[model samples]
Target: MSNEEKQAPQDQVEDVIESEVAQEDAALVDELTQANFRIEELEQALAEAEAKAAEEKDAALRAVAEMENIRRRAAIDVEKSRKFALEKFANELLPVIDNMERALLGTVEDEAAKAVIEGVELTLKTLMTAVAKFGITPVDPMGEAFNPEHHQAIGMQPSTEYPANTVMLVMQKGYLLNDRLLRPAMVMVSQG
Candidate 1:
């Protein structure tokens, strides 16, 4: 009950309070460290997720570009198919035109066959008009310079009236469908 005894008990209480405060500080520091580690793990996970999303986005864009290219190519193919669709049919009708032309040439001088000739001429004119509407055009290369791409040389002849390598005569006229050659013109080329 003296002053020393009283001072000793007070010191003991102060030590106990200091010890509790130190333990609490240590626990708080440990919790803070664990929280910092967790935050770092979460940030790394977020970065990985962002990288993966970027990769997927790039792949999706590439796929879309490829699809667009394929669509464009398909459209071009369809347009080409539409343009050349009548090539085969026009080819088959060429011989009929040639035969009609031959018949007309033969019957021109006959006076008695005048009515028949007129009918045939009218028919041929109608046929020509019909074919022309469908982009079927004749390649009559008479007097033009010989183009091997459009005219096939059946034979060559010497000519003073035409320049060298000119198309002097067409044996069989060619036909075109949509500016594309259905058949080459059979021609006689002039020689130098």
Candidate 2:
């Protein structure tokens, strides 16, 4: 109704509007700060996830490489087995060499017997040549110290010629296929 009363109402309205605007500005600032912080946190999390993925990929590649190496080694082992398959069969035929040697040295009566012995000699030489190609060497320790690992003690005899435990006489010869001993020599060991 009066000028003073009308002015008071208008002033109260302006104060209320200013207060509301201030509160709205403060809320907006707080929301923007929170959103920026959340974005930074998300970026850091993504970086950590990417690093973990890279590490896992490296481990998987190493595992695959190791498996490939193992497979290659196994292939080599299998090839070796196939190459050495005839080892056992060759070892069993060693007695034939001894028999052939005996036939050559034994006294023969007639010309026919001598011819047969000469034929056996040719066969023995051929067999030895073939065996040599396969890395099979004869373990003929004629004058060497007798090792029980390579020689079998068939008899103990007194000998002034040989050292103690040395091979005085090799009865049946031994053989080796590679580094492995196929058969030990049947020998006479000199006693101390």
Candidate 3:
């Protein structure tokens, strides 16, 4: 009816609309905050999962490296076994060779004995040749400098011919299998 009365009702309607808009804006802000929190939680979970995966991967790599090392060691062990398989057999055969050498040294110079000596000599030569083919080398340290690693000093002798600390006489011959000493040469060393 009057201008003041009409303006008052219009202002009331505008206030109601403004109040609804404010409530809606507050609801939207709350929802956006919740969504950002959920994203942060998911990011943290993803980071944790990635870190766990990385740790597992590192463990797997270490396991693989260890397996490879084991395989390499096994291969080396197999090769060594193959190289020294006949070590025990070679050791057992050494006494036979020593006896044969002793027999040859003790033979008398008879006409009939000479034929038997020749036969024994041929047999000994054949046996030595066969053993030499299998990486079995003789360690005959005759008149060489005494080495404790290869030669064992049984007794020291005063010698004018050899220098001091030299191998004067090899008592029993030593043998080597693949450059590894099977037995040390029993020798008499010159006194220093």
Candidate 4:
């Protein structure tokens, strides 16, 4: 009931209020710290996701480039196949052409035989034209420099008109299918 007694009780109440406020401030600081840590963790996870996405993008681009290269190569292969489709057939017909050439080289003095020869000559010309249309070309090395790639020398002989190592006579004409040699020309070379 006195003044001192009243003052003591009021001080005790103030101290209790200060203690509660301090406890609340400490809890708020702890919550803020936890939130900040969670934000940092989220940022790290986002960075990792971005890196993975970049790697996947690079891999996809590389795969697309590889596919394009394969497509280009396949297109080239198909074009080559289209150009050389009749290679085997042309190669098989070479022996028939050689025999026809040999038959044409023989002379016929009789009138009836001359007509037959003319017919055979015309047939050979027609066959040659057909083969040429399919990119089959003749390799006639007669009177030119002999090359091992296109010409096969059966024998060498001394020649007066040609230089040494030159093709003197073509024994059997070879054929080429589009720049590639189907058969080598059999030839006689001039001796060095």
lDDT of 3 by residue, 4-100 (tens): 9999999999999999999999999999999999999999999999999999999999999999999999999998998899899999999999888
The stretch of ten residues in a row with the least summed lDDT in candidate 1 is 103-112
Q: Please identify model 2 stretches exceeding 4 Å from their true place.
A: 1-44, 47-55
TM-score of predicted model 2?
0.70
lDDT string for model 4 (1-192, tens) is 999899898988988888899999999999999999999999999999999999999999999999999999999999999988888898789999999899999888999999999999999999999999888999998889989999999999997888999999988998999988999999999987
Per-residue accuracy of model 1 over 1-192 as CA lDDT, tens digit each = 999999898999999999999999999999999999999999999999999999999999999999999999999999988888888888889999999998888735677688888888999999999999989999999999999889999999999999999999999998888888999999999999
- Candidate ordering by lDDT (highest first): 3, 4, 1, 2
TM-score leader: 3
Off by over 4 Å in 1: 1-36
**Residue 109 displacement in candidate 1 (angstroms):** 3.6
Backbone Cα, N, C clashes tallied per candidate = 0, 0, 0, 0
Instruction: Output the lDDT of residue 120, model 3.
Output: 91
Residue 49 in candidate 3 has what lDDT?
Answer: 100
User: Would you list the C-alpha lDDT of every candidate in the order shown?
Assistant: 0.93, 0.86, 0.93, 0.93
Q: Which portions of model 4 miss their true places by more than 4 Å? A: 1-36
